[model samples]
Target: MSAESPPGLDLARLRSRLDADRPGLVTGPLSARLIEGGRSNLTYVVDDGARTWVVRRPPLGHVLPTAHDMVREHTVISALGSTAVPVPPTVLLCTDDAVLGAPFYVMDFVEGTPYRRRDQLDALGADRTRRIAEAMIDTLARLHAVDHTEVGLTDFGRPEGYLERQLRRWGKQLDASRSRDIPGIDTLRERLSARLPNSPAPTIVHGDYRLDNLLVDDTDRVTAVLDWEMSTLGDPLTDIALLVAYTEGEALGDEISSVATAPGFPPVRDLVARYTATSGRDTSAMGWYLGFAFFKLAVILEGIHFRHTQGKTVGEGFDRIGASVAPLVARGNATLEED
Candidate 1:
């Protein structure tokens, strides 16, 4: 494998490792380019003219404990390869920092587009957009239907008290990233702590499930579900609620993905209806889950905001990330209040 690699990726060492571990995979010298639009992990597209694959590694600096877990990401994706869920086939998981200065994993690069803007969806027209949205929901249903035990992920995560642990986990994440005041954040956290919703039968939760995280083909099929950084065995409703929260659009501001605002993208009620019909999971508690989703999103955005403040983040969209935190906090509080 060999091109002049990016700052975090050493193409030469990667080529060496691939040759040693997965012989004959690389046909020529390797070249790699960082794939943008990912905020936490560093993803790069590596090519040797004959084949293409993706490499995922943790961020450059200021990584919070347990975040950007390459092993967990690789494990879950590898386990799900034979399931109904669409995932890129993993090549190898390299824990030797000597290879990439961080633990990383390689997967076949599925060909598809990650539509991050409403304009991009608008170009697809209303009917196609609707089909894409339906496909996205259908994919989620299929994922939630998978039995963790059957896939050898029985120890992946503690499903009991999953919602409670998620709240605490993101709370600690927020504390670790504190740099400025965020309105209603503390209130939202406290209220969330005061009343935790009961979870349904556990499923493999896609910690961040939304349109942009998926790669869609020209036929509107979701070819692959990317970004398993926070995936676990947990309440499937949380996934549905988070997807609903994303479809709310602009909660993270225009700089971030707002593809749901695109015309013909189904409404929240329609989204929930589709999920209910497909997954058959009761969404009666979605109000509370939506609130939790907002809180989680706020903490996530605030973490990014903190990283941006410290110049630890890469890519173009981080400059405006800080400004988006307060609104997310407010939205979270409001959602909980309504709930």
Candidate 2:
């Protein structure tokens, strides 16, 4: 075993642990590379010559409380493996930090493309792009339809007062990562707090549901939904509004995902209508949810910006994250005011 390894993963220790626990999973020495495009949790694609898997761990430093729980992520993904949410199959969950510096989990890697930019969708043609987007909406509807209790997720999260708790939670997350003043953020939060919309029946919500978080196969079907660090049992409408928010103003930011900006992507109203028609849930109050979605995204990017400033962030595109926060705040405020 060599002393050299990726920044966060020690290949020698990882191979040793996997051999001791999940024997024979790896046939050769482990090599890993930190996967890019993730702004919160650190993801690595590891291979052992014959096999490949994904490793998810927390960021290098400045980790906010309850933000990147490996057990929570592992549990939900494992639980949803039996459901129709299209999560990767769980291999093993290693809570022992002696292996990976921080808590991390391993899952078999699925084959698909996580389309991030508009150009990628452009190559797929308008009809294919429309189908992919529609498939994403339908997949989300299916996830919300799953019975959490039946799938051994009865205590995954508290559904009571979910919207209020989310508001408070993200607000505190923003405070935790505040390195510089983000103008209009406080006002946006206050406006969202003023009139909380009544949430429908709670379901398993992928807290950060967006196009790039999903992996699509060549046939225009959503093969898997990646990044479950923010998932829990909560208001399903939050997922819908978050998806809409991602597509709203992404054209202005270099690092922001612009998959929705591609031609033939369905508009917000069409997405909402498709979701409503599929899930039978009303989205009449999405105006406020959209505002909160922008607020949440702003806070997330601000946290990444803070991490980048502290030299705790890994991978590229982090330098451009801070510039995107103010625009999201402005959009959030405008959305709330319009509502």
lDDT (Cα, tens digit) per residue for candidate 2, span 41-153: 98889898788999899999999988998999999999999888899999889988778889999999999999899999999999999999999999999999999999999
| Best by the lDDT measure | 2
Instruction: Encode model 1's per-residue lDDT on 229-290: one tens digit a residue.
Output: 99999999999888887777464587557888889988899999999999998998888899
Provide the lDDT at 181 for model 2: 88
- The lDDT for every candidate, in the order shown, is 0.89, 0.91
The window of 10 residues in a row where model 2 has the poorest summed lDDT is: 1-10
lDDT of 1 at 122: 92
Error of 1 at 274 (Å): 0.6
Q: What TM-score, to 2 decimals, does candidate 2 have? A: 0.97
For candidate 1, the 10 contiguous residues with the lowest summed lDDT are 247-256
